[model samples]
Target: MSALPAVIDGRDKRKNPMNIFAQIRELITTTLDTMVQDGTLPDGLNFDPITAEPPRDAAHGDMATNAAMVLAKPAGMKPRDIADALAAKLTSDARITSAEVAGPGFLNLRLAPSVWQAVAKTVLDEGTAFGRGTVGNGLKVNVEYVSANPTGPLHVGHTRGAVFGDALASLLDFAGFDVTREYYINDGGAQVDVLARSVYLRYQEAHGQEVAFPDGTYPGDYLIEVGEALKAKVGDDYLDKGEQYWLEDVRTFATEKMMDLIRSDLKALGVEMDVFYSEKSLYGTGLIEAALKDLKDKGLIYEGVLEPPKGKKPEDWEPREQTLFRSTDHGDDVDRPVMKSDGGWTYFAPDIAYHYDKVQRGFDLLIDVFGADHGGYVKRMKAAVSALSDGKVPLDIKLTQLVKLFKNGEPFKMSKRAGTFVTLRDVVDQVGPDVTRFVMLTRKNDAMLDFDFDKVLEQSRENPVFYVQYAHARVASVLRKAADAGIATDDATLAAADLSLLDHDSELLLLRKLAEWPRLVETAARTNEPHRVAFYLYELAGDFHGLWNKGNEVTSLRFIQEGDPATSQAKIALARATAIVIAAGLGILGVNPAEEMR
Candidate 1:
């Protein structure tokens, strides 16, 4: 990787050089500054609201700016008056071929063909780094995901959160953030006790004793191996021991074994965590006490009685005095109890301590990826972080909706291997990791996604993963064909090609689409959504494929000219640049770009 260029005023100077939209925005701002100095506009007017982006209607122009409309009221002038003045000033630049005012005040500008040609050249120069951005500005971010209890293998619900969180982490890292991927092992909860009992039953069965798994115990066949392993280690030492004699030891052994199973499942899907913080570690340590004490110091902790929850029957409702955190002060709907009347910590207490740990680690931002069932936990968690950090650090929680599995156009059944739910391994094994990852992100994280086993594997345009991968494979084919013809297709040679030969509208449209990549990356990173990358890649692939189909009708639009290697190299450069961006976007999504259809 090349070293990033110098930083100016906390913004990377390279951002403008690689992004044409940013460059044009810079030119618009400079023109506005000149207008201010020339007394055409007021000296103190703010220009931050002005924007330069692609026109909604491509027929209007190549790019559009709302400079005239945004500045009209501030400059105390009519929009058309400002528009005409701005247009005249903008047309003076070499890159701006024409600037026309439309509607009330929008300034639609067409760029010189060389401007689009230069974008293709820049793509060849930067390779995958073309859209890499510094929007994050090196902020430290901690992303916690897949913190499911160590009871069994990760299920499909956990699978969606895992893929979303991992891709978001990679996306943030690509956007220049210092990111830490973490998982919180829920080992201190009652569920682990149930797992211990379940494994004990399996252990008894392993010892040739018939045992029945009660309703509270996990009956998954996945635990049978753990039971056999436990029996092999103990060798009938605790064969008929009482619950007190073996519960603690068996709990420890079972939790570790389940975590190993979870780790293997995650590895099969290509996920690795930087830290696995245990909930058990927060106990018997001063961490929990210290976190609550900080809240007490801030006057956000008190002994109080909360009103009975709404929709509760009067006969079943009781108000008990508890040690509660003043969550309502930080935007929660109500105060939340940290310690119950019996002096035992509630589930919320440990969570507050966990987030407190993240804040103490000096993370500038904290994000939690959770299943949709945890939606109610969002407000209280954010309230805890706000009180803990004194409003210094920010917390964002993303809830991934359920993933419904389909096969042959019907709902898929549960996996017997997992007993009641489908395991992550079950999904990954059916379609492979690349398809699983890409299809998981085809929708917004909060929206319901249907993962159809048959549809995802299809080779049609309806399958987004296949469409995008096919676009990449097509570009690879173009390069091989160019190589067979004895053409120099290296990046250096392509960058030095006579790019003016790429003046066709179809080629320019593709270049314009490529120019939006850096801007798209920054927007997606700011919103912490990696699915936008998936949507953009699909659209880009469509544009590339559309151009390829157009080539069959218009012989001049083909990537390979009959005997004109100069024009051929210019066209191939555009194709290669498109592939470079597709690979970069897929890389962010943790999907490998396909080199061939098979």
Candidate 2:
């Protein structure tokens, strides 16, 4: 479950062996080139814009190309005339059953049934390699996510970002990108200072002294054990010491415990980060000074006085000279202050240094996943990245919105142990990691998700996670039945079957949906969206379920035909191919395909 897809090399465009859409696109391009060489059209025509896409209405054809409309203006001819000529050329190919010119010169193509049958065979032959794409070109990408402050346990918000970022990294890997999943620990922030004080009170209570948890302190029961552990290690050593005497040691010890708790929580949800970057390492190490020096040398840093913010100006809004970064020059709404008037760094200073370190790591692209409340940080961070990298690296910031939990159609109660927000471990313990991962990706990162506990566990069509898993399980059951009936249904045998027998419309529809996988993988990777993979798997499961239901009414539509092993072999090949795609898609989402639904 942890292994990523293999990277694909080589950029030869001579008919992709596994991608049906790319194969047809290549065929169309070659035909157009032949037309130009024969002087049927004009010379030096650009074919980059010629696209092959499925028609909005499937009744029009299996696939439709806008080659005529795209090339007509450049070739100095009417679209209909170009479409008519292209139709004649395409009709000569054995795979194309029909190529008709429709309104506005759309070239609608219907392929022979054998073309789709070949797609099923290809899926069996390639297995998980069926939808792998080479679009990323093996470029290095750094995805920083779930950098929750080391103050307490992770809530539901951080859980969503963790799932989304991990899936997106896997999706990018599937598309051939070398991805590094990273987490930047905010251990140097003021929040960690608060955490040290909170643990100090707990440590006092461990020594049989009653301590009151005031408004600014964390009161969760999780820290009670940390207090007891501190008492066990060094009893009363810093009981009455001054703040400076114990602040550093307490902060270091508390931050380590909190990070250990976070790691355990993330592991419960099946997340493993490759790197955990500490913010405290940036201070007194010349990193922040070096980053600011880089900006100062570029003439992007200056002393300035900022005007009061809109709608919320401070009562004492006196103007003071502060060191600011010229974020406006890099497309921010306003310049941002990096150093305060007191000669100390603001919060933005450390963030700028962090991104500068990432840029120096030689990554081609950077992606930051933050919670929705950090919406204001998006522009400033992007501007900093653009300025720091000199516009050489692209940064994409994904903000995951809130998650509302439900159980039995009612809002879930907060964990007593967590005291405020529900802990990620609470959710994972209630429902396993597979359901959590799948439901988290059912919506885009920007959209809110309502995670219904009971619905996800229900064995019905309305539950997409259950529905998809059932489809794969159903295929397993069918294979078992075929084996019991003394039929050889291995991949080698299925691949060599006479797939020409699979000409029914229901069978061909399943093949068409399977053909869209490679294209879908490339599109999802290009857009940095992993939700598309979940959606595709749900739709594919529906197509497979529909074909399975059709067998109830049509005797010939059943996958295991009685007294006809040849027909059964052809039909079972489609079923096996569908399962292979479902398994591959679930793998990208970091979920193991369920062999049985219980």
Candidate 3:
């Protein structure tokens, strides 16, 4: 007999009722539409400007939207006049208690307390899926990230990009997109040529020859072991046969070893990709020519002379006609070259072809994760995708900034001479993958992260990684305590409890934040920023901590209520929701939610 599938095994499309904020926002939009239909306003109305964002002040209630101000200019009326009419239509909603027209014609929606309570119930009901959003609309997405050069071990800077990209891909997957994580191997560049020469030097040393570092060769000692492995495999066949006999074989062997090191590095960081696309594959397969030809078919590829660069123009400059893509036709600052003067395809050629391949693969959306040094390449890359896809597929590129490592009040410089280059394995071995991944994503991708090796290891409140994990463990501790007291603490029992018994302001605030999970998911997924997930989890943890602190002063606020199993279950329901949301957020960040802190 076949086994029954788990609840999550089946692809069930769960439906959720509109929270008060959503219901009120819908009311405001519908009212504006009705006004247009009645000829009280313009017939064609654009609702993009009407956004129902959470108000900063709690007294203003759940959400606020600018429906009135949006229609004011279009309807040939004052914002206040439009606001009054919109307010009248908005209060008509049963979900919203009062729709007050406030400063600058903004509509402030005051939802009932029951509404916020309902949001908590939604979190409990959906559990980890509570924040799942449908904004992706089942669009296929190809997220290319951590395409680091296969030359050496990954450092802290590479770790940040790896974590960010993995989380971003998971966020898109959870948000209802068919997502594929991809890595583009930079194996066909001059840097790899340098890597080959470096590996050869190491190979000679493996054959017992003394060697000194060259100016352009990779100085890192990683290639030394790779060299030894090659010598063992081929058995001195090319020891004195010169460059022609051994160069290609050594390059291929060295490249594979480097890639193996990189794959191990990514695995240490909990990053796994569905595709590992080789840049060399685009070279001999006529793929680059085809991508360039596709651009030429539309007059985008042409012979052109580039304008002199902004900061420096060589005195020996002579205008050379070369094949360039008309990237300026889209939004690039300048047209870019597809081929160099020597007739070899430039680095950008294979990149354009890779993106073209992605578009051909039926992906509706494309995202690339690059380091901040690639900022100059963003505009041209986006222009290429726009022109190639005919504006059909959208490309969003996220640039991760540098990670500044500090230890003992000094900047930690990883010197290869000291043989102290911190590999991904070194970081994982020191602090484990969960700590490494969490600390890497604690900051915004575009913001510089100060990752102190010492600070991250401290088991204190300042470390957000530990703080958030502690909240989840605290919930588990509460459940254990309740079970010890002979109270039912399972999810089914807790979920079935009457949640209306949870009435404290602190308790309700945590629920309110829990309710925002769905909205936050949609925002993060649409923007392709998973760092927002980490920030949201931190804030949610802050709320949980506040509730825990309140319990110290107010004993009734505790999840365990003496002599009241029903009341205890009700309070535990709120804690369960908190744990579930924390788990969901950690899942997106590729960090495990701790069941108990040890």
Order the candidate numbers by lDDT, best to worst: 1, 2, 3
Question: What are the per-residue Cα lDDT tens digits for candidate 3 across 1-598?
Answer: 1111122113222222333445555666777888889877888777755777789997777788877787788778998888888777767766678888899988787766676766656777777887776666677888899998888888777888888989989999988778899999998988887888888888889999899987888878788898888889887887777787887777778888998999988988889999999998888899898999999998999998988786887998888888999999999989999899989989999999999999999988888999999999999999999999997777888899988877765787776566668777777888889988898888788999887878888888899899999999999999999989999977777778888887788988888888778778866776677888988999999999999999999999999999999999989889988999999999999999999988
Candidates 1 and 3 compared: the better one by TM-score is 1
Residues 1-598, candidate 1, lDDT per residue (tens digit)?
Answer: 1112122123332354567888998898888899889989898887767778899899999899988898888778999999899899999999999999999889999999999899888899999988888777788889999999999989899999999999999998888789999999999889999999999999999999999977788998888999999999998988888999999999999999999999999898898999999999999998999999999999999999998878766885688999999999999999999998999999999999999999999998899999999999999999999999998788889899999999899997675444668889988999999999999999999999999999999999999999999999999999999999989899999999999998888888898999899888877877788999999999999999999999999999999997999999999999999999999999999899999998
> Residue-pair clashes per candidate, as listed?
0, 0, 0
TM-score of each prediction: 0.96, 0.95, 0.91
The residue ranges of model 2 lying beyond 4 angstroms of the native Cα positions read 1-17, 412-418
Best by TM-score: 1
Candidate 2 lands at a TM-score of: 0.95
lDDT against true structure, model 1? 0.90
Error of 2 at 183 (Å): 0.5
lDDT (C-alpha, whole model) for all candidates: 0.90, 0.89, 0.83
- Per-residue lDDT tens digits of candidate 2, residues 391-452? 87788898999999887899875653457568888788888899999999999999999988
Clashes of 2: 0
